[model samples]
Target: MKLLTLRLTQNMHARSSLLALALCVGATSGEGALGIFEDHADIGATRRAGSAEYHAATQAYTVSGGGENMWFTNDAFHFVWKRVSGDVTLAADISFPTAGGNAHRKACLLIRQSLEPESAYADAVVHGDGLTSLQYRETRNARTYEIQSGVSGPKRLRIEKRGKYVSMSIAAEGEPLH
Candidate 1:
């Protein structure tokens, strides 16, 4: 599908609280009211609102939102998600319409425990610069941690949730997800 994704880690100082520029995300999904999703909304209190649009003809979703960052105690990004249980998997072919935003900007396939900003969660993410990683928060209000991947600039990213552990697969440009 010729997509792009991102990931990042390491506790560095956060950027200034600037206005969130919309992140252009194009993804392939199923047909439903909002594609294969139950609903989409901002995960936490964000400076600006986020939106999600499903294109049936293209089977692509354009999701836009902003957040201070997708780490630490709270998050503020738009999420288009469905409720799933008992060993689940989520994947996406992602790309940004524009290039060269924040090096830390990301598009990810996430599994979160709740809608709350402090909910425990895990995400297989790709960053603007093509850094990919598996990031997680073990408990609500806990610090976020990351495990960097050997691969980068992946065109496809997938997350599989087993009983208690989460794993991921990544595909570079022109390669299949493995």
Candidate 2:
């Protein structure tokens, strides 16, 4: 899956609110029509809110939003998801439209229990500052932690989950998965 191009500017507060409104009304309805992701899910109830839009021609999704953080005991970002059990693999090409957003801003491939803000989950994330890591919450409302990767600013990322194990991989633009 190819995800959104976050274009964060100086007006973060206004943009966040607008993103939420747009996601609530436009994300699901129009997004699926353009075949971005199979479905959408909300988790953690974000403070600033976010949205997702799909561009059919490019086969990419443009997602935007703001949150205090996706750490500690809870998270606050928009999620695009589909239900599955057992083992699964997710891959995506991600990028930002501009270079001026929050350094901690992220695009991720996430797997979680439910829509609860503090639900147990694991994800492979690429941060705005080019840090890539595997972040997870062991249990509901648990403190969030991460195991950082050596790679940074990868253009593609992948996450795989099998039973209790989760793994992440990254690659540069136009390169093979590592």
Candidate 3:
């Protein structure tokens, strides 16, 4: 005799948010796959909903969401992540689908401590207007701070973590990480 079986595994938070997401955006499991990350969107203090889709042919990910800002003590934005320890590097080529959106709307390569709204984190982000910066919050619920970069409208952004230090680099498409 032969038998077939199915297995399901999910974190409690992720399962709960997935349910809320279905009701809020009618999103499906396939629609939220962002290439490397199985989970998309962090349920936080946000007034809007977000979604992400991955295109295997082009090896690209598209994420869209609305948030007042990624500043202050808390944030509200779509995040796709995989937990990692020790040193790591994250880089991505990001662009907006339309020219019209909040000037502050941003795409980022982020490393966070937790899914909490005010988790200690750092990221290299590209804003709608081409502004690039390294933003971080050292402690939970603490004020966020930024170190603005000279590069503007970079087609690629990278953030690397080594020990307690984090560095950022940006470049135009086809250019080396600077």
Candidate 1 structure quality by residue, lDDT tens digits, 30-64: 44777667788777776666667766666567766
The 10-residue segment of model 1 with minimum total lDDT is 16-25
Per-residue alpha-carbon lDDT of candidate 2 for residues 17-72, written as tens digits (9 for 90 to 100): 11211111112334465253555544556555556666676766666665545688
Clashes of each: 7, 2, 1
- Name the best candidate (by lDDT): 1
TM-score of each: 0.81, 0.79, 0.78
**Pairs of residues clashing in candidate 3:** 130-153
Q: In candidate 1, residue 61 scores what lDDT?
A: 70
For all predictions, the C-alpha RMSD in Å is 6.3, 5.6, 11.3
TM-score of structure candidate 3? 0.78
Higher-TM-score candidate of 1 and 3: 1
Instruction: Report the poorest 10 consecutive residues by lDDT, candidate 3.
Output: 17-26
Question: Where in model 2 is the C-alpha error above 4 Å?
Answer: 1-11, 14-31, 34-38
